[model samples]
Target: MVDQQWTGVRRRVVALGARADSGQVFGSLGHRWVLEDPLSAAELAELEAQTGARLPEDYRDFLTGVGAGGAGPAYGLFPVRRVQGRWRWEGDGAELADPSMLARPFPGHGPDPESLAALLAERPEEEDFDASEEFDDAVEAWDERWEAVMFAPERTAGAIVISHVGCAQREWLIVSGAHRGTIWSDCRADDTDLAPLVDDDGRPLTFAGWYTTWLEAAELTSRQ
Candidate 1:
């Protein structure tokens, strides 16, 4: 049974979700979305066991009470089964996160490059390489280290791809760790960097905040 509060939220969501398929919600941007059948309790449990990660409460509620797929921001919410295949990053080499790291908790804080700096300093120079080549080689080596830090479990860990916002931009829901339940934007994976989706107050939007905010916008826009 869905809780009273989220049941209300889900009702609003269902109303707004209908507009996604009609193309009125997004105003001819042509993004389409639809809600699928909700996942059975058994199915959700099986999904968690298979992935070794527990989902956040609100998202889990959405999946169980509302629908497992369809009718979401951007392209749409992916089915839970899609996680198995979406484990790898398609955007860039620097933001890689694999299936193995899904259960880990996301670190509350951002990247810590101090350890990476020390690790790089300990690496020995390449043997018999010319100055230019060696410099290039060293730079390449450092780049790898930098990428590692960016994608470290604390940085990119415990996150699952939730949806793609087109143009190679994507969204992830933090399933474990400190930021669990927060929605993150991966638009910068190939450019600037990953960022949390924030509200007008600059607070990172939790799953409920992100979705409800969109629903509110959709309602207001539809009225206009």
Candidate 2:
């Protein structure tokens, strides 16, 4: 039986790509609507073994039924591959996810709000320093502090970076915690905390919902 979750997804993506103006859509050129071959049962099992966590069901079905990655939201979904006999996802910032820590719980919150505000306020301004060298030193010092508070490895445990939205921004899929199967947006590059990707009803978006939403929009854009 076909998994209803991904029914007709591959076909619809291909159909949209066939449209002459599909490439006109934003980010279409990057993926060119090309999806990699789906993973086989053995490959999927090996991936699960390597990660030490079974992937979210919706995402797992996508890998087995649709494709491992490609032609997805933003620049496209990051593809997972085996190198040196080990499985890992490949893309900008994809390495941020540590597979060894996939089973841990994702942090429920980021740095304390008051402290983060204080840190942001302390961000150095070039005009405040008379010498460029002095300003550079100040900026570097501030950046180190910011990274320590914001980009701590523990912040993203149990999550994997699934896609990049450019500008050093990326999205994550929670794999082994209360938020498993849900997608979260990462905007730490802009000094904002990671948050769940919610739908029109303000509910969290699952992997199936996130991908299908993008696919539907792409189809609509291509036809127009």
Would you list the C-alpha lDDT of every candidate in the order shown? 0.67, 0.91
What is the C-alpha local distance difference test score of candidate 2?
0.91
Highest-scoring model, lDDT: 2
TM-score of each predicted structure versus truth: 0.69, 0.96
Taking the tens digit of each residue's C-alpha lDDT, what string does model 2 give over 14-100? Answer: 888888899976788888889989999899999999888989998999999999999999989999988999999998999999999
TM-score of 2: 0.96
Q: Worst 10-residue stretch by lDDT in candidate 2?
A: 1-10
Candidate 1: C-alpha RMSD to true structure equals 6.2
Instruction: At residue 5, give the lDDT of candidate 2.
Output: 72
| Ten contiguous residues with the weakest lDDT in model 1 | 85-94
Clashing pairs in 1: 34-71, 105-177, 106-177
